[model samples]
Target: MNSSFPRLVEAVTLCFMSLNESCPRTVYTLALRGPLYLLFAVIVILIVIGNLLVICIIIFSQHLHTSTNFLVLSLSVAGLLLGVVVMPFSMVRSLETCWYFGKVFCNFHSTVDIILCNTTVWHLTFISIDRYLAVCHPMEYQKQMTNRLCVAMIMSSWSLSSVFGFTITLLDPEIKRKETFHMNCFGGCFALHTKEIGVQYSIIFYFIPVSIIVTVYSRIFFVAVRQSKLIHSYNYNPKAPLKSKGFKATKTLAVVIGTFLVCWTPFFMCNIIDPIIDHSVPPLLYEVFMWLAYLNTMFNPIIYSFFYRWFRETSKNFWERLLNILI
Candidate 1:
């Protein structure tokens, strides 16, 4: 009994007490764990509520039913799914440093994570294109950006992301071997990518989309500047309205692109570098970068509230009506 007591005490710190190959848990002090749990829980709640509110606003507000707003709605859905279907599970795994849900679910979780994130990136890229057409080619904007085209863009983003995510996570035999090797312990779940895989993923999901966004936005800026100068030079400029719209586009570009870079660039940089460096990045630092990227979803609705007067007004009306109903 005395000899077995030592093993029992040691087992308390492992993910599975009965299994010799169980992963050890990162047991935090009570003081630290309390705050960490609270923080992640609050973030998950906010992400879900904010994305849902954005969807509601877009659905009920007639003025918000534009092609661009449809794309925004799709983006909100992706955020909502991430918050609902992904973040809670990740929160537990991240905090506990153990995977309770077994190997199959782990792959599913990882695949969904890749798909939703890529979906968000693709949506942002398409939105940038939409803005380019609206600001730089106002006369052709309505004619060129038809509802069919918008639907096509949305469909393509989702389908391509799904294919890529599934192929990498489930279908690739080499990646499967690497992932299994990484999850050597019974209670651990991790996906390990080779250096080549990491670089390919980063290029496809981050660099390509970001490059397109930057190039298109730069063109929009120059065109807007030219239009503003033309309007200022003429006393009676018919294109004054276009110049005003361009200013709005500039504001939108700054907030959207700036926030995206601040949130995601670190994570993607680490994603590529970690594999090249043989996963030298500390786990805590990697987790921090991952959560920071997740914050982009939470911030999307807040951005709308701040930058969109129409959204604010609609939100106000929504609250007032709900209060009246309750009263």
Candidate 2:
């Protein structure tokens, strides 16, 4: 009776184990435990919480809500969504061999992955333009980027990105969608862009945006460096303050743009090239590149904390206040 009772308890515990806990052994050399999963978990947490902290600081600190900083806040919000909505699904799809989230969710997840990522890119470009106006045309910067206009620009950015991403991707005919992206059998769920679809999206999302980012930042760097030289060479002057401040702001944004490019370029390259190469890239390699792109969302706040002095100060104060309330 004692032995039978122990066995009955063990059987009940096995039946109640999580779906994830019941994964069968595989021949794939995957580490779903220990260091690998831990690292992925950390990345997701930092991306979500770091972006959230940025949003909180921006919301609470009225001074930080300038036209340019508003653009930064928009990007951070996109990053927050990327981490909260996109990364967890990607992580599960990467770790597990099955797709239990249903077909409707598969479409929703794929669409959102594209939407949030596209929005982040637009915010980066607009932020660069804002910095440019501040550095190159201070008098006009105030006149041009009014608070109402900034709000309008933010709305336009989101609307344009969604319209572009969703419109282009969903325009593929019914048969094509089934052939490429559909998850049919409760098995692995990953968005596989067909060669035609890949080429179309790469041009729309990648090539054109890369051209804009490069062109804008190239001019920003030249103007910022030239102004920084003048500021350093002179004694205290009235114009010196504005020039120095604008140059510092440009520098901070330049780092942010550079980091975004570095983190996302690999995925962009692989994504475009994979279709051209008949999707010859190994699944694991593709997954690595994709996660590397997601890591940009994580790196955004780290870049801000490192380079942006106002953000650092505000963050410090925000944390202190929260700690005091908790204590």
Candidate 3:
């Protein structure tokens, strides 16, 4: 009986052995655990390095300093901060099912996570608006999207995101009381939203932004297609320099929007539905959705590399200069 009691206690391990308030730990098999760690490590490394390259390229290459690229830079900066400030600890917490960083750091981490991710979404929405002007109203685009105006948009994006982040973190239910359930015990960290809050959050953060992006891009795509046909039919180059550039940029950013939708829609859908269904969704499923959303940042740089000649050329030149300095 004594030996069996020890085995039972070992089987039901708490994240903090000495603390009764600690959440129970989840134990995974070695095979599953090894690959999960390796995958997250690779994702974290890629997200950091990829966004860093984007930031350096945009900052150093002065010719790329247009309104469009400024917005792209803002997006990249948000992704970089997510990778550096929020992701590593999130990776640990997600995999281990425990928050070892304590309640204070956990709140800080959660707030930054919301801010960065929300900022990225806002950046995308603004970029879509910028592209709409360029492609749909080329004559007014240059006059409208001035450097000062673009900076203002960037600042507004960050400010709104900051407000939302802090407000949401302050409103987290876990901050006010301990959970009786195993999943949300003291060592476990996650926001607990009621059905009403979940619906409101999803509507505000996900649905509204996504709706704007899709509507604007739908207009941009059809307009581009019609313009292309008209240009080809004429067999003579019109004053298409602005239109051509805008179309290409639109195409690249359309891919970005599409990728963002794919990666995040599932998570947000679950976010809304889980609370409606009394939070019956498994914890592991939430972790998987969250990580999938995180992977979007890593993919953004890869998308740029594939689609943007400027990205490829600047990257090649930048690396060459570094190699020359080293040699």
Give me the candidate number with maximum TM-score.
3
lDDT digits (tens) for residues 3-63 of candidate 2:
5432211111211135443323122333333456678889999999999999999999988
Q: Compared with the true structure, what per-residue lDDT tens digits does model 3 show for residues 44-80?
A: 9999999999999999888999998999899999999
lDDT of each: 0.84, 0.73, 0.84
Superposition error at 42 for model 1 (Å) = 1.4
Q: State candidate 2's TM-score.
A: 0.82
Give candidate 2 misplaced runs (Cα > 4 Å). 1-33, 168-185, 236-243
Clashes of 1: 0
Pairwise TM-score winner, candidates 2 and 3: 3
Score every model by TM-score.
Answer: 0.89, 0.82, 0.91
User: Residue 160 in candidate 2 has what lDDT?
Assistant: 80
